[model samples]
Target: MKEIFQQYTGFIMLFGLGFFMACKHEIPVQPAPENPSNNNPVDTGQPCDPNTVYFQRDVLPILLSNCTMSGCHNATDREDGVVLDNYANVMATADVRPGNAGGSDLFEVLVEDDKDKRMPYGRNSLTEAQIQIIQTWINQGARNEICGTSTCDTASVTYSAVIKPLVQNNCSGCHNNSLASGGYNFSTHAGLVVAVNNGRLVGAVSHAAGFVPMPQGGKLTDCQVSQIKKWVNFGALNN
Candidate 1:
């Protein structure tokens, strides 16, 4: 009876030990979670104000759009001893009294009423909005600043909505009717078509091989380039 009891107790112990060993080996171990912040960094700086007149973003584009042309304020031209192509050149060359748009010669020519000498030589006058932006920039001391701002959406790109404005802000200064650099005029849809037909538009804007990269001092953002390609691929229409 004592031997039988010992055998039964030993069998129970062995069963319990086998079950513990199976559980220890069979259970799957989970890995530790990764820190998302470490993998992809994000900007935590202050957001840019939409109303503020940023020099590099707002003023440079305006100057590049309305000034800097073949016979205007471009480096080679430097008409009337004024070069509006860069911030340093603009301050030194043009008669600009910072914080005084009314007294600034640069602002004066923009608002000049005399059609014969109203600046930009002969092309269309600057939009009222454009004038106000420049005036506000001058009033704000015309500081050379770059703001942190970025927003891009290519969901509904169109010629009138996207391409025209993009070209006007970046390319019109050199390729308008007054300039026509390299025999290309981007002022009108008809004029733009010539470049599109000859594959210059895509090549130039994309900074592709053998074609001149556009926007001179800077390259287009990936978003802006995507917008241009979207418009062009959609038949480069007058839409």
Candidate 2:
């Protein structure tokens, strides 16, 4: 009887141990929440101003790079005694006609009907987009401001890139070693420097004071004139 009692007691203890070992602690799980409003991440806004024409930053650079080449509207052609290579020249010509494109000769030639009458002769006329810009500026009163400020220091520039090519392409044709126009030769750097310092080269471009506006009558763009002025202001560095 005593042995059976002992065996029963041991069996009860073992069962309790097994039950405790088999049981496990449970952890609560939660789902990650989603952000419904943040579908796109970038801000959208207008990039450029639609009004207020920028002369120095926009218009001047365009004219210099595209319009004022050697055989084009440069001082060489002297076309219409108009030179676009300076602030005074461009302002002196652009008109303030609200919708009339014929207010200025510049606009007139740009929109001319006959091929010979059109500017950029023997070439495609100014695009509608370009004409629109000029017209807009003209309509905006054609303000002329040098350096765009009363005392803004002009940026320094070089001669080789700005002035040399201009002289070589336009003036050198008639003022080179073979044919020295007005007893002048711009074929060499030294020769050019001499003429510029002596006021002859500049004189040639001045309508009221010089021999003649170059290329016989064409005009250079404003940027070219600015570049030349900057170079001269910098002592006309050869490089």
Candidate 3:
């Protein structure tokens, strides 16, 4: 009887050990942690301000400055048989569809990867803000509508307040450290002074004869031109 009890006890212990081993095998194994790397993500930046994006005020300026400049998409050159100088011409040739920026050839070429295919080819690319403005304009119906509320505060116009923002927004895409189209840099006061001394600054903005109408996609608003004239007449001070 004692030998029989010892055999039973051994059998029970073996069975328990086998059960434990089976249970261990049945449990799922955890995966190893992912290794870290230095692949930075793309910066999409902030969503565009839908309320303030107007075709004439925001979008046209970008097109003019970057796309319609001489020897580019202007009426004179009409590269690829596309003229972006005016609203009708742009709508006709650019394949701009209202409410669809991605589908529009104009917008697509602005962000194109191929150097030869991109708009403003062989020049500085547009900024995120500028691109977003165009996107928002197209999404908002690509109308010929102007910003009715836009008012130039000619009374308080100062270099830092008015002129700096103007140049930075409208001209700096090509005139900054990157491209500086026509060797004319409007990205700094000194550069602007050089243009001013040569009389190109006023002539260009005023769209006068013997000078290229600047901000190339379109002319500056009458108010904006007047304010710029005031600044220049006031000694173009660095205030």
Candidate 4:
């Protein structure tokens, strides 16, 4: 009987192995959750704050690039009877209420809409960061000051980073030294100041003392205009 048991041991071991294999469960693997930093390559370097929206730096550009189009919010067109061409308009009775991002038309149009109700109308929607910027700005009293001005070192934004290219692309082609339309050259800092001082750069570029609005067929965006204003206000810093 012992010899017979020994002979069958190998067969029993095989059977046991087969049973164990049959009872094992297969698990499906899942992909890892994306890290926002890893997922977005172009995210701004600084961490965003809900309390202090950089109004002059962050929010204004978004408004200029998206909402303020020539046929829409431009000073000349004022389509829909809404003129969002400058800071005053943005801070006025109809645009925003300081310290209340939730009540701002700027925020509502960007955040609370079906596409039809959105501010850029036919364009793509605003990014979460862009929306957050406006909301944070409103939450911060929506004043027209640089962030960190009264407190921390509100990061010094460079003219080259924002204003220079804007002038080059929008105004230089027509208003550069080579062209100097209406005796105005926006190609250099002095040129821009001269234009502004001579009363050829502000209002609508097309403000006819007979100077045509620039960039040929289009208006300088609200953001672009804002950049120029900021430069002028900042003593038109070089580089």
- Candidate with maximal TM-score: 1
Give the per-residue lDDT of model 4 (tens digit) for 69-167. 557776687766676545565654235766676766867887755888875676556557567777886776665544222222214545677666566
Clashes of each: 0, 13, 2, 2
lDDT of 3 by residue, 1-239 (tens): 99999999999999999999999999965321121121122222434334756556676667776776667788888888998766667777787877788988888988999988876787767777778888887776766654334445788778998998788667876687767888988878888888888889889988999998877555787888898888988888889
Q: What's the CA RMSD for each of the models?
A: 23.2, 26.8, 17.5, 18.0
TM-score winner between 2 and 4, please give it.
4
Ranking of candidates on TM-score, top first: 1, 3, 4, 2
TM-score of each model, in listed order: 0.68, 0.37, 0.66, 0.42
Reference-based TM-score, model 4? 0.42
Per lDDT, the best of the predicted structures is 1
For residues 1-239, write the lDDT of model 2, one tens digit per residue: 99999999999999988877666323432221121122221221333345755444335444543455565545565456565654444544333233344666667777888998776565545457566777675555544322322322246455655577666544554566655656777767777877678766665554336456654434444455556666665676688
Deviating ranges (above 4 Å) for candidate 1: 1-45, 177-183, 216-219
lDDT of each: 0.76, 0.55, 0.74, 0.59
Worst 10 residues of 2 by lDDT: 32-41
Error of 1 at 199 (Å): 1.9
